[model samples]
Target: MLTMPDVRAPRLLCVEVHEGRPLSFLTETAAAHLAALAARSVFVPTTTRTRKQYRRIHLPGPPAPYAICANGGHLLVDGESDRDWQGAVARRLAEQCAPLAEVLAHLERTAHPDWTRKLRTAEELFAYVVTERALVPELWLKELSDWAGQRGWSLSAQGSKVYLVPRPLTKSAAVAEVVRRAGTEVVLTAGDSLLDADLLLAGDHGWRPGHGELADQGWTAPQVTALGERGVLAGELILAELLRRV
Candidate 1:
């Protein structure tokens, strides 16, 4: 086991980050305002997506302390990836289930050539994905589930997309590891998708923007404090509420 310093929750403030995608809605002016409230912060951006995808998008300012990438697979301190954390993650993946080679083989077979845009795997987290928004067939999700289940995996379909992931890999699980290292009083969390449901419930309290997978399905945790606001407004509202509780 990797030895770590004792960390108390940071007043329990957490957010499910879908890369930096949601932040793109806010103008530079609005983003600056939002960043100001969370200064000197430890932002745990939990996502099912990978770190490279998160880096592709830009946010307004640097998140102080650290920013989580790859759905918590990587906890970046001052923008540098943590080696020890990643090592532990690697160990978990090995013990968990299907190997990357096995998953990729299944992906290659079941994925449609015309619609498949990307086939990605994070060996550290033991996850795979096939994203094709416009080319999805009506029965794609059901078929994907059958394929994944046969291989002892799970599939999740978010808005305009689908994901193949292992049952042991979860965003909230990574966030919990970060919290143990942070040594704070609480954790505040937010997200708009079903992958985020775990993080929302895992935290002391959370916030859900007006859109994304969970919002569409009307999924809300009792403590998550779902916001009715939409788009940029939702981003603003979430930032504001997080500061209020902190």
Candidate 2:
């Protein structure tokens, strides 16, 4: 197992797990090894999808000690919110920018129904239908960006949904808070989307499966390893990196 020189006693780690996307070992032996490595760890799953939407996915047995839900809105323990932790986030997002209602209004107005599907918004993540990525007028997206910018928010095109999120609302920010509470000494993280980039970069070392948005864009950073793997490999990739740190 790898170790940072300044510390002893198996380092604590914070890991963000992306839902539905599999990392190779996560469903198999690799996850067990990862569990053995850290002093403690938290599974942070960031998704624009809500908690109920996430629940459909089968997380491996003996569930992670902690889990992040609602794209970082709900920090769950035994599948329930750790209110104190999640409340801090809601308070911050509330204070920081326009509400989800306003963002959804803009999305509905800007998005053409034919190209959009599954228009939904959670307390933490707000998104709407977008299809024919190349076909979507540049001006529309730009206008959306401008709209978000005015509200101190951001827009990202991930898969079908055009995400309108608060600039201050980030999976990384919420994950960091949980890490602090866990008193983790080192963090090992992974993900498969543009949204996961922040958490991955913040880790001591991060892995990106070749199939993901970031890797598809290309991995130029020394901090990120393009695993040339996807699905379960995406989950396994992160476990593999954490194994070395263990």
Question: Which regions of candidate 2 fall more than 4 Å away from where they truly are?
Answer: 1-46, 130-134, 219-222
List, residue by residue over 72-127, the lDDT tens digit for candidate 1.
66877776788987887777767876766787787788778788777766635544
RMSD of 2: 8.6
lDDT, candidate 2, equals 0.66
Tens digits of per-residue lDDT, candidate 2, 1-246, equal 222244532322323335545322244455465555533445555565577766655544356656776667777777777879767877888898888878888777878866665566776455555576766777988887987899977777766567776776677777787688778777777777776777778777777876656777785357777786565545555676676666
Q: How many backbone clashes does candidate 1 have?
A: 21
lDDT of candidate 1 at residue 206, scale 0 to 100: 91
Model 2 poorest ten-residue lDDT run: 8-17
Which has the greatest lDDT? 1
lDDT of 1: 0.67
Most accurate candidate by TM-score? 1
